[model samples]
Target: MTGMKAFFGTFIKEIKLLTRDPAGLILLFLMPSAFIISLSLALEGTFMTVEKSVNKYKIAVVNNNTGHDGKNIIDLFEKSGKLIVLTNFEKTLLSEERARRAIIDSDIIAAVIIPQLDKNRDRRAEIKLIIDPGLANEVGSFLQYSLQQYIYISEIARLNIEKNMLQKSIYPQTVEYKANLGTIASNSGDFSIKKYYALREATTDIIPTSVQQNVPGWTIFALFWIAQILGINILGEITDGSFRRVKVSPTSERIWLTGKIVPYFLINLLQVLFLFALGVYLMPKIGLPALEIHNTGALVILTLAVSLCAISLGVLFAALSRSSFMLSSFSAMILLLMSVLGGIMVPKFVMPPVMQDFSMWVPHGWAIDGYMNVLVKQSGIRDILPAVYRLLIFSLLFFSAGYLALKSKLGRI
Candidate 1:
C-alpha cells in the first residue's frame, strides 16, 4: 500500500516537473503535434488524390500504310484523348539514331512505326513502339497499356463490322418434310461471338483495385515510424540526471517506467485513430472506398503492442548508451533503417525477392503487416493473429532486454 502511494506521488511529481519546464513540455507535446499535422496534411494531398491527370504523350507516328483502314486506325488513336500524334518525321527524323536522341532529350515519350499494309498478305498491321527507359515506370506502363487497349478496341470494332456484313447475306433455305409442316430456324453454325463478348466484359473496369488498397497501408506505416521519434526525449532526461534523481525516491522503478511510457502509448493510439478516421471519412471524397473498421478492437490491441515494442527498443538503446547525443543519432539511424527494411518507405510487393524474405525478421514489418491485414484486407482477428502474435513476442523480448540492461546500468551508476 505504501509503495503504491509513494509511486503515485512520485509519478505526479514527475509530471508536474516535466510540465514546469516550457521547453520540455513543448518537446513532449507541441513538436509531435506539429509533425503529425504537417506530415498527415502533406501525405493526404500526395497519396489520396485519385484522379491524377497525366499529360498526353508526344508520339511520332510513321505510317507507311496508304490504305484508308490504317489511317482510320491512327485517327482513332488520336481521338482517344491519350495520344498526341506527330507526323512530321522525314527520313532523317525517322532514323533510329534520331529517335534515340529525341528520347534522350525528352522530346517524346515514344515513337510508333507502322509497317506498310499489303492486301495480298495477312491483314494484321505491324506496329513498332519505342519508349524512353528513363521515364517513370508507372507513366511508361500507363502509356503502353492505354495504347494496347486502344488497338484491341479498334480491331474488335472492325471485326464486328465484317461479321455484321456476313450475317446480312441470305442463304438458300433447306426445307425438310414434316407431318405438321413446321419450319425450324437453323442454328447459326458456331458464330465466333466469344471474342466480342470477352472484350465487352473485360473493358468495363480499367483502374485496378490494388492501388486503392495499398496506399492507406503505406500512410499508416509512415506515420507510426515518424511518431516513434518521441522516444528520444526519455533518453534526454536520463542523460541530464533527472531520471537518476527520480530513482532515488521511494517509488518503484516499474511504476515510474509505466508512467513515462503511458503518454507515448496513448499518443500512438491517437495516431492510429486519426488515421482510421481519415481513411474512413476523407478517402472516399477522393474516389477511394471507405476502409471497413470492423476489427477496431484488434487494431487497437495490435497498435499498442507495436508502440510498446518501439518504446522498449528506445529505452533499451538509451540505457545501453552513456551519452544522450549518441543515443539520439544511433536510435534515429536504427529506426530509419528498420522502417526502410520493413516496407514503410517502399511497398513490399515491389521489393526484390531477397528483401521480401528478409523483411519477415523485422518487427516493424510485422506491425505494418498486421495493420494492413485489418485495414486494407478488411480481415478479422483470425486473419491477423499471426502478425499480432509476432508483435506481442517482440514487445516482450524488447521489454525484458531493456529492463535487464537498465537494471545493470543503474547498479553501476
Candidate 2:
C-alpha cells in the first residue's frame, strides 16, 4: 500500500538523520561503554555478606585445663560435625589471646575456653565462650549450648572414675554453674559475644550485587537516555513543521508514527548488546568475575521488550514537551530520578522495603529486574514472564499519552 511507502520513507529519513550525527552516535555508544566498564570495575568491592551454614563456619577451642576433661569437650565439638574445629594455632596449643585475635581477624566464628575444673563443686572453675559480633545469634547460642552439654559430661565421667576407685563416696546430685557477662573470662566467667562486622546471616550466592547491578543498571540507563534524544529530535521536527508536512502528505499517520519509533528502538537494542557483551567477556580480564547469563533465549526476548519500553518512553517524552530545552531538561531529570529508584544506581536487594516497592512501581525497575533475572538469577522464560508483561503495560501507557498528544496540535507542532 502507499501507506507502507510513507512508513519506509519516514524510517529512512530517521536513519539518514542519525547517520549525519556522528557525534550523537559516539555519545550514545562510546560514552556509555566507557562509563559501564569503569563503574562495573569501581563496584567490584562493597558490602559482601557470607551465608550462614555449618560447613561454612569455623570455630576454635582453647583448653587450659590440661586435664582429660578439656580433651573430652574438644572431642564433643569435633564429633558434632556442624563446623570445622581448630584446637591449635600455628602447630601449637591455642592461647586465649591468639584465639581472640583469630576471631577478630575473621579466621574463626567463636572460641571455647575451658578452665581447670576443681574437684569440689563449690570451688569449680567456670568455662568461657567468646564470639564474633558478626556471627549469627543462633551460632553463638549453639556454641554455648554445646559447651554446656559436653562440659557436664566430662565432669560426670571424672566422678565415675573417682567412685570406681573408692566405692563409697556420695557427691552432691545437683549441677550448679554461675554465668557472668563481658569478655570471655573464666568458665564461670560471663559469656558475651563481641561485635566484629555485625554481618547478616541472609546472603545471596552470586557475585556482589553492587557489581552485578552495574552492567544492567547502566545499560538500562543508557537505553532510557535515548528518550531524551528521541524527544528532542521530535520536538525539533515539530517546531520546523516537518511533522505538519507529513500529516498533509499521502503517508498514513499510524505508519509514520511507527516509523519514528523503529530507528531508536534498533539503536537501543544495539546499545544493550554492546554493553552486556563487555560485562560478560571484558570484565573478567580486568580481574572481576564474568557476568553470567541464566537463559540466553529469555535474555534475547527480554532485550526486545526493554527496547520497546525505551521507545515508548521516548514517545511520551516528545508528547509532554513543547520545546527542545523543555524536553531535554525534563527527560534528564525524570530519567535520573527513575534510575535511582529503579535499582540502577543502587541494587534493590540493599534498598529498604518502601524504596524497593517504589522501584518496582516504575517501568525502569521492571526492565532492570528482567535483565537481572536473566543475568544473575537462574530464571527461565516462565520466571521472567511477569516482568515482560509489566514492561508491555508501561509501553502501552506511554504510547497512549503520545497518541493523545498527536490528536492535539502539540505533537504535530
Candidate 3:
C-alpha cells in the first residue's frame, strides 16, 4: 500500500513540475502545432500550380550540310516554337568538342549535328542528336519526333513538285499544275493538325491528390519522435532518487509508469488528430482532395500503436542514460538519424535500392509504412497486419528492456 501511494505521489509531482515549466508546456503543445502549420505552408506552392506549362527545350542546331534544303529545315524548326536555336558558329559546329561544351554549359537540352555529306549510297544525311541523358525521356522523344516530321514533310513536298513537272512534260496538253495551299496533314491520319498541335502543348499532372492526403501521416510521425525525447527526463528522475522515494510508498510502480507515459502518448495522439483535422479542412482550399475519413477505427488503432511504440522507445532511452543531459543528446541523435534513414526526410521511392532495403529494419520506417498503408492506401486491418505485428513486437522489446533497466538501477541505489 505504501509503495502504491509513493509511486502516485512521485508521478503527480513529476506532472506538476512539467506543467510548471514553460519550456515543457511549449514542447508538449505549442511546438507540434507550429511545426505542422509551418510545414504545410512551405509545401503549398511546390506542386499545386493551376496553370501548367510544358517545359520548352533549347536545341542547338549545327547544319554542316552546305545546301539550301538544310537552311530551310533549320528555319522550319525555329518557326515551330518548340525549340530555341543557337547558331553563331565560326567553324564546324558538329565537332565533338563543341557539342560536349554546349551540353556542359546547359546552353541546350540537346544538339542536332547534321553531317557534312552522306558517303553511303543511301544519300540520306547522317543527323545525330547529342542529348543530356539526365533530361526527361519525354523531352528527348518529342525533339526526335519533331525532327522526323520536318524531314518527312520536306521530302513529300519535293516529291509532289517533281510529279507535277513530269506530268506537264509528258503531256503538253495536260491541265495547268497548281499547288493546293491548305494546312499540312498529319502523317498518322488519325489526328488533324490542330489536334496534334493541341496535344503537344498539353502537360501531364506531376502531383496527385492521394499524395497530399498522406502528408498528415508524415507530420504526425515527426512530432511523435520529437516528443518521445521527454522519456529521457523521466529517466533522470529515477537516477536522482525520485523513483526510490516512490518505491517506499503505497502506489503501484506499474500504475505510476502508466501515468508518466499516458500524458506523452496523449500529446502525440492529439498532434496526429490536429494534423488530420487541418488536412481535412484546408486541403480543399488549395485545390487538393479533401481528407477522406474512411476506416476511422483503423486509423485510430494505427495511430495508437505508433504512439505506444514511440513512448516505449522514449522509456528505453531514459532507462539507458545515466543523466538528463546525456539522455537528451542521445535521444536527439537517435530521433534525427531514424527520421533521416526512415524516409521522414526523403520519400522511400526516390531513395537508392540499397537504402530502401536497409530502411525496413528501422522502427520509424515500419511506423511510417503502416500509417501510409492505412491512411493513403486505404488498407484494411488485415493488409497492415505485418507492420502492426512488427510495431507491437518492438514495443514489447523496448518496454521489457526499460522495465528491467529501471528495476536494476533502483536495486543498485
Best by TM-score: 2
TM-score, per-candidate, Cα-based: 0.53, 0.63, 0.56
Model 1 lDDT per residue over 1-413, tens place: 86777666755765575566668444443444344344444544444232122223676666664544336546756886866777665435465445544544446656666555444754454555666432333555665565465555545555554555555544324432222312211111111111000011111111112323334444345444433344455556665677777678766667767767665565556565665565577656655444556677777777777777766776677666667667667777777777778765654645677876667888867876776665544456776778778877877887788877877766665
Model 1's number of clashes is 0
TM-score of 2: 0.63
Task: Compose the digit string of candidate 2's lDDT tens values, residues 371-411.
Answer: 76666544679867888999888888888887678657543
2 or 3, greater by lDDT:
2
lDDT minimum window of 10 residues, candidate 1: 194-203
Per-residue lDDT tens digits for candidate 3, residues 227-266, read 4556766776776777777667566567678768766766
Q: Compute the lDDT for candidate 1.
A: 0.55
lDDT of 3 at 188: 17
Candidate number with the higher TM-score (1 or 3): 3
lDDT of 1 at 282: 63
lDDT of 1 at 338: 78
